[model samples]
Target: MMIKNTAIIDIGSNSIKTFVIDQEEKYSKIVGFDKSMSNGFDGNKINNFDTFVDSIKNSINKAQKQSSSKVKNIILITPTSKNKNHLISEVIELNGAQIEDNHLRQLNKSMIIKYKTKLTHCFKSHYVIDNKIITDSPIGINCGSLSLNAIATIISDEEIKLFKNIFSKIGLNLIFIYDSSIIYYLYLKSLNLHKKNIVFIDIGSSTTKILTIKDEKISLLKTLPIGSMNITNDLMTLNISKDFAEKIKTKNIDLILNDHSSVEIPVWEELGKNQKQTKSYEFIQSIVTARVDEIFKLVLSSIPKSKFFYSYLVTGGGSMQLNLIPYVKSKFGIELELVEPKQVKGIPTFWNNPSIMLPFCLNSLIENGYIDKFNLFKKNDSFSNKIWYKRFVDLL
Candidate 1:
């Protein structure tokens, strides 16, 4: 028997990554992985198309080499950071027809068609069969009609088309295209966190999203233009390189400690001699504090207070900053929990990094049988074509 290879490519403002898994792997464990620095993108447009294309190709090539398998099809994750809350429902009058998976699939499709949204991440799902209330699923039941109520997250169609063009250039077919925020939400939901007035905040390199789940219904409160990169940009005003600024921001700066008044940084002096430049630790802490404060002010003023409160959770590349949780707790008067997926046993250790949590947890969700509910093979455009692609379908 031949092994079937599947891949997931994640494109974000920070990096382009490739993760591989095959039928031979146990529990959908990631068999191979590689990444390269991303050039940049603004919505549907790539900043440097040629350079970006090369990065994508190189990342995939390296991952394939590591896994020693040619990828049959790919699941692409694009960081849209686009979140619009839309409540939509679709009803199917079966006329005494038995409900099957196809009916459930059609109802989801109908909601997308009528709602005019390209992507819908149903945070809350329900099925009403005939006159009976069913929250789980209506499959295998003979019912007169069924309806699906979904509180979905919507993204623009152009962003998806942008990825399709990239796929064609890379000579790969996509199994599914998902917004990074939705993937984060799915991974968060899979963990089954404490549910009373929870706020799911995903702070990326360039953007931040706040999704409030109150009483089982999720709402997209805001997507702010501010992010961790902005803090790094602010640090650059101290006459330091951006790379050094970001490095210290993530690993060195400690907001919880006030023991130090100034920290010395090594600098090159007059060709060969090395000199130290002293920076005030208080000033460094002030820059980060001000940036986070700005984000809080914008969030509070823009959204309804009724939707924001209690149980705060933070994740993403930005949340990896040291001592952030304690700082947030002390300043905001709300406890901040750093959300991380429990490590899967019997996998390589690098799978546990919080920086790659987006893809790692997504892979876990697939392992836990969440993707089965999506009917991805039945409806995705990338899997719809080609006879050879069917071989990989059984692996799903």
Candidate 2:
């Protein structure tokens, strides 16, 4: 059963984006792309359902036209608010048979049933076969019994229903939904970069998602109520429109660009009036750095000892604040790596913008056989399909 072309919609606080891709054998043909302002989404919730649907429709239609394909299935991705981390362990007997992929699949299925009321997503931490610990999947090894630890996110039923209703209004099925942070982490892990210990961060428009990979297995997932939008709002202290504020925030707030506090930038009270004032780069830096620093402090509170991780990788619009790397080094003494999606054959150069890169990665991961066919977790018969989310990844 080969699904030829599919659409990926990324709904974020600031915008709605879509990519209509033609999944090919060796490469994904990216035939369509769009990023549109989100209406109906008032940062925290969908306040106007009708307007929200319109917004999503606009984004989807623009991309679909470019692809010349009517996309029916959507792998929806969002930076959802309700995600929280939980640790679960499950054990099973193999009866001295060789541990195969199905063995772990069954083990995970059992674990989900026990916690079906809670799990939105689950990722393996590691496995112990016959009382011996292993990070690699014990697929071919003969084992009497196997046990595993996993990190899973708990999503609210309310959120899932909201997704359903939104898609229903748009006249499309909500084939699958994924939390952006979790999917972003999954895409990275699939690269097999050999990063043993890492604290991955994504600063989205209204939320910051953090996930930890310790000892080559995922350990935790977290979401915080902070993002680049805060920085833009903070710049409104000068009484500029949100549009103008966002422009300068993106243009000036950078490591190489914003470093000279001694330099001053011109500020306009009303550009048409030609009235102007001067503010030191230091002023803007203070406002921007303060919020970014707070974001990291909050991350530390959630996952203490993040400083000990071998790598601190970050993405999303906030990562464009190049100064953050040196700033975190000075404040917390942690090195931060700005992760960009690697160039797969079909990805256009502009598609790598951190804010909208998740869809591209999702398309690539699907083609590369990195993502499991796990249907959000096949907990019941209603999700009828040969479900994928296997090993969630074969890393463990």
Candidate 3:
């Protein structure tokens, strides 16, 4: 059945974002968009369950209101960790000149077989292959072997349950669970400008999601523990309030200071000290720049340059760093582009604005029926199909 209006909720380490959309056979209409600070789930940690659940409900309600329609299906995308071993193995084999269509299929089957314990809904596999990466089904090429590097992520069942339970409590029908990275990648694809080798670094508040897309498919997916919170932690170590530290971090303004230049550093009351003087930008920038540099270098290493692919895209909250883009370009000497979600069609003009663009695009895809296209995998019948499996195994 063609569901009318669809809604998508993306729960990230930094925010809870929602999108509502409707599409006919010919056209798609984005009706609503909303997001709220719900960094309840940060990386593998859940700080406050109550606050997270409440924030989710509020975001969904706002989306429903803006759309002026009941949410037919809600696709929840969470950053629960995924296993990347299978994809890595596939890349290794391909690089070893042992890859074929059958090999790819075997890898896919093995992924499901291994992670069936965690998977809960229909899904799709997107391969981001560097030039070194080889496939048996090469469109039109004759080469000895392909040395490819890949990153694959498997969404977890428990993560889906968290969103489903939240929706159930809020009186909404849960649709399919999605990979937030996948959703965001599709948003980039819709732009049609990023059809080359590109990596998207979504540096959120507490966690950074590194994704590489090549040949219009996901090549690598990784979630790192480092994020903007590290800068806050650095400030907190100086005994400063989290709020004040956040302000300074965001401003990113460096004031020229002589030897007389000094900034107040908070000292703990237990230590019986009010404030200590220190140079403002020198110390903080050293910590922040070092962390940010490590992240960029790590992302660069993940992209195999031998593959002849060279396009990097930066986004998310940490990208708000004023000098980050230029600094990355100057430091890495690789061409990097900032992704603009407002460039896509059917996206409302308001959402085209800063910061909200990525989530807004993701929310619209879910609210519309586009998310339904992702439910391509059929339910498994392992019990009844045991004989077929056995026969297949015998052939192998």
Candidate 4:
């Protein structure tokens, strides 16, 4: 069987990652993978646009070298900065004509034009025709009027322009740009794990995102400025390097203290001189625990008052710290489970790392035909048969 290939570029605040996957009917393998650290933010916004574009180009070039096919288009997963989700409804008068695809397109187009925000993804929750709710497509049905209820995930137009400019420089077309939170929600729903309300927390290097899933759909999304890096910075108060602080954060030391116990860690004083520093496990735990508490508090404040019927799920590189599960449970009173890529089949073990889970989830979604059927990308209406449309005809 011939395998189809897809490439994904995930741009985050802390790193840029590129991955190429080749898949048959039911299985897929990661043929290429590359990553580069993002330059820390300049003030409140991302550093230089040109510098970030260059980093992305370098990662994509490395991935292309490992793949057998050239990557001309990519699925871009963007950060949640300046992104918002809104539930909108619009009524269309059919004038006693049958509803058609064109009418549905017009409705969506009107919403976009009215809001003036660049759409990242839009999901049609349901349609009401003549006061009757319809879950499926309402096309070919005779009706005087119809209403569309949709959830529009959007970001600033400036951000969209920035990504388009970056991809243009690299000779790649942006196939789809999805908010990172939406990607996680889709991935979780694909696993059939949303029979009940689910609270998802993704702790990235620079920011943490919280998503609320109700009735198997995303109801709310909030991003906190604090993340795992804050804990690393907090450890810097001990006069340790960032790298060393990161190591301490991920170390498999017990955070739960029945009694006061101290652990001595070696610190580099000079080329050959090292000093053993005694630090109580409670002290180290206090630093990390404080940050985690603040993150959950913000998340709780954002979500509506409701009971969660399912386990809280947590993912991302920051959430991989040892004993994080217990820390969250003790502070938040909710047991949290770390999401493992092993739950997703047909992918290599190397692709299971938390650092690249976003790309991995995207590959799985594409392989299962979810993205194309859902119209996740912006549609091109021009008559010209561009190379992108020719290559991804099914998607268009």
- Tens digit of per-residue lDDT, candidate 2, span 1-396: 134557788888888778777765655566777888898885667788888888898998888887767877677775466656666789998889988898787887787778665566676556888877555568888889998776566656667667766776777766666666667666776777778888888888888888787766667677788988999889887766687777677666663354565533345554366555567887777788888888989987877563775588888877777666787888888888887766644335765677766776777666666555333254431222333223122211
Candidate 3, residues 290-335, lDDT tens digits: the string is 7778777767666765423657777776766657766776666766
Weakest 10 consecutive residues of candidate 2 by summed lDDT: 387-396
Runs with alpha carbons beyond 4 Å of true place in candidate 1: 1-3, 24-26, 40-44, 82-85, 91-124, 127-134, 137-147, 151-157, 194-196, 268-273, 306-309, 344-351, 374-377, 380-396
Ranking by lDDT: 2, 4, 1, 3
The TM-scores, one per candidate, come to: 0.78, 0.83, 0.66, 0.76
| Tens-place lDDT digits, model 1, residues 327-371 | 876776667888775675433465455566677766776676665
The better-scoring model by lDDT among 1 and 3 is 1
Give lDDT: candidate 1, residue 329. Answer: 68
Alpha-carbon deviation at 71 in model 3, angstroms:
4.0
* Candidate 2 C-alpha RMSD relative to the actual structure: 5.6
Task: State the displacement of the C-alpha of residue 331, model 2, in Å, after optimal TM-score superposition.
Answer: 3.3
Candidate 1 or 4, higher lDDT? 4
The Cα local distance difference test for each model comes to 0.66, 0.71, 0.59, 0.69
Q: After superposition, how far is residue 270 of candidate 4 from its true place, in Å?
A: 7.9
Looking at candidate 3, the ten consecutive residues that score lowest on lDDT are: 375-384
RMSD of each: 5.8, 5.6, 8.3, 5.7
lDDT for model 4: 0.69
